[model samples]
Target: MKIHMLAAATLAMLAAAGVHAAPPEQAPHARVLQLDSNSDGVIDRTEAAASTRLAARFDALDANGDGRLQREELRGARKGHGPRGGHRGGHRHAGIDALARLDTDGDGRISRGELEAANAAREARAGADPKRAARTGHRARPDLLAQFDAIDRNRDSLLSRGELRSWSEAQRPQREAEMQRRFDERFSAADLNGDGRLSRVEVDEKMPRIASRFAWLDENGDGVLERNELRPQRGR
Candidate 1:
């Protein structure tokens, strides 16, 4: 009787402590799938490469062959690049900060050479191991900064709606498809209410951190998000 009682007490204690557990790291099929994906932390290269084309196109517009571009070079890129009907005040610059600063050589014109250099640097780093993407306790590297600057359309430190729309429009179809796939995958789980749409309420309840993270990424203020938009915000 004593042995049986002791066993019962032990079971009770274990139950109270909730200690007989290795976490349910793998549960349902959907949960495991989400874990596999977010864990990889792979930035889609095809999408990144497609964005480079916009930089290239912008460089082509800077007639003087200098190595930096300004708002003037963005003649047809939404309001001549002056805010692009974008908002960049009260502690934020609408999505164009990097473009204004893309003058790698400080030549005041984003030339073909600058575009090539930026693209080369981006490709080199992107080709490295995913483990290296986030160096230990360090901030973004120069090449990453160059990548952001290369896409800043209004020459502002921030990206505006116009710039993002412009970039999306310029991307190759295949890259666009791949990026959209990743985006859909990332958001699929959190949309738990199963309404075939995402709501701020649902996102806040199921994925609050992602909701906060989305503010910087959703430059266009659209409900749907994209990786290109998120890339610039990774610094935040």
Candidate 2:
């Protein structure tokens, strides 16, 4: 009778604590599955190399220090904390995401006709539901449409995979320069002392994102970040 009573009490205690003997982890994400060549349910460094975005973040996302990215880590990333466990604003490959949206036929290329159709569809949807369009993060970019003729080098009215690649390559240096300029502007603003550098306190107060990466960015153990020491990561 005493043993039965103790078991019942323990079960109730466990229920209250929300402790389970074995909580099931969710299956790996579809993107992860596609690269999970070994079928072992997690992405290793070799498998991750194929994805530039994942490769750049692999070290940061490996929460267990086990060199393997599990579903929970990926989920955490989606929720915006997985990158070095920091509250930095969301990071996305906007160019890549935009291109994927443009390639609606899944044929790995975009034609003028397809582009028109996509624009028409987006306009119709936006007209029908202004709020939905305003809320969506993937709204069509007018800048790309404006440059369509210039990007179509062959006069074929189609954007081949290579053409897109070439355009992005051509734009890379300018984009990187712009990113650096913006970083400089922010750094200058945060440098309360006008010393051309940011101390920990300044970073914590003005730039929370840099605060999370202070130790890493503060090279030479100087306890502050110089302009050269704190550059934005490319393709972020």
Candidate 3:
């Protein structure tokens, strides 16, 4: 009788553990590493120094050297440093791609007006259907709007070099938060009961990009992201 009681208690603990899972895999893709540009393996003072290098990265990726990022620059069609925009025959290479919906005009060109749009589009795209608005959740969180305001400090109706430069101080922190938020927001939306937990069914709905990125967030080994699973420390 004593042994059976102990076994039942252990099984119950395991059952609870099985309920609230963690982010699936491991660290995000080499996006952060590649951002270093210098190939330092670890992103040092350069990337975190400010919006300077980042702005320059954005500029360089702009291809035309325009102050803004555009859809054309993001298209898999353009000729870039590596192999022109995509995987051709299992090619091993590096590349860049920004949010296409930010091409406000549908013209595929991202002007200063489109930078924030790109970021927003990226958040939505992570767990969203490209055909629908990304904000389709049970209760709208002010996070999205707050994100816009943070980047659009001047509120002049557009993002500018001055604004982006001023924002470099927030670059690293924002990256940390944004990366995590992108993961939680996806799970939160699918958690219909608002129980702060997710099952495999909800987990299966994850988008390709989300699935590939931040698998490490699932630390609990469950199929969902629980409150405790978000305990990662954020920083520059």
Candidate 4:
């Protein structure tokens, strides 16, 4: 029930925003990781301050008393697992907030009936000001709006959850391949010394974010970042 609710809430928000889920590699903890501005693969106290809720529970989530949040620590926190196995309720991941917006009767939950009504409301608004709606809808990724008509299989002129999910799944492989190709190009460009790895100095000069977390990403403490080190950290 909890998973389904979250999924529906997320889908509704995505449909309204006219954006789709990010690639799989970027989904898990991607929003939290974005706070790692230094890109060292963990969220420090300063970075945690970006989210007010996360900042308040930082110490409790810092299981090792390191004063920073590793990915697992955050994952545990989101799942309501505290350091002592207590439930840390209300870890914000946008689901509750999304529900609040869509739950028209303030019943604290969104039913299929409610969702359908909300969809109709959105379509009416879009009809009233299509040019303005188009501009607001795809603010996350303007490119998605270009493909909107094609993805709207029902021709209702509104993106339903199924259509968007199907489109995103279908585009996953191509998106991942393109991401890898771009990463390879950037890595080659950053490896100025023709080496297979990036020295601290090279990363600092070429990639400021990696430079901030250079020591951490250098898993072997070899004072450099290898190609694998630069890739997204999955299941961290």
CA lDDT of each prediction against the hidden true structure: 0.42, 0.60, 0.41, 0.58
Q: State every prediction's TM-score relative to the real structure.
A: 0.29, 0.55, 0.27, 0.42
Regions more than 4 Å wrong, model 3: 1-164, 170-185, 206-217, 227-235
Model 1 clash count equals 17
For model 3, how does the per-residue alpha-carbon lDDT over 1-236 read when each residue is reduced to its tens digit?
A: 99999999988998888855566754323333343333322222223222332222333333222222233333321233333223331111111233333447766433554565555555566446533332222112223234556656767655444444444434535544554464466456667778887555554463222233235656667667665553333222
Of models 1 and 2, which has the larger lDDT? 2
Please report how far candidate 4 places residue 179 from its true position, in Å: 1.4
Q: Please, what are the lDDT tens digits per residue for candidate 2 over residues 115-189?
A: 778778868867898765554322444545677787789988777766765665566565545544644666787
* Candidate 2 positional error at 16, Å: 5.7
TM-score-wise, the better of 1 and 3 is 1
| Clash pairs detected, candidate 3 | 21-222, 22-218, 23-217, 23-218, 25-215, 26-216, 70-110, 71-108
Q: What's the residue-level lDDT of 234 in candidate 1?
A: 16
lDDT, residue 12, candidate 3: 93
Best by lDDT: 2
* Worst 10-residue lDDT window, candidate 3: 89-98
Evaluated at residue 75, the lDDT of candidate 4 is 70
- How far out, in Å, is residue 149 in model 4? 4.0
Which residues of candidate 2, in runs, are more than 4 Å off? 1-10, 16-98, 106-108, 116-139, 233-236
lDDT of 4 by residue, 198-223 (tens): 99788767665546677766778888
Highest TM-score model number: 2
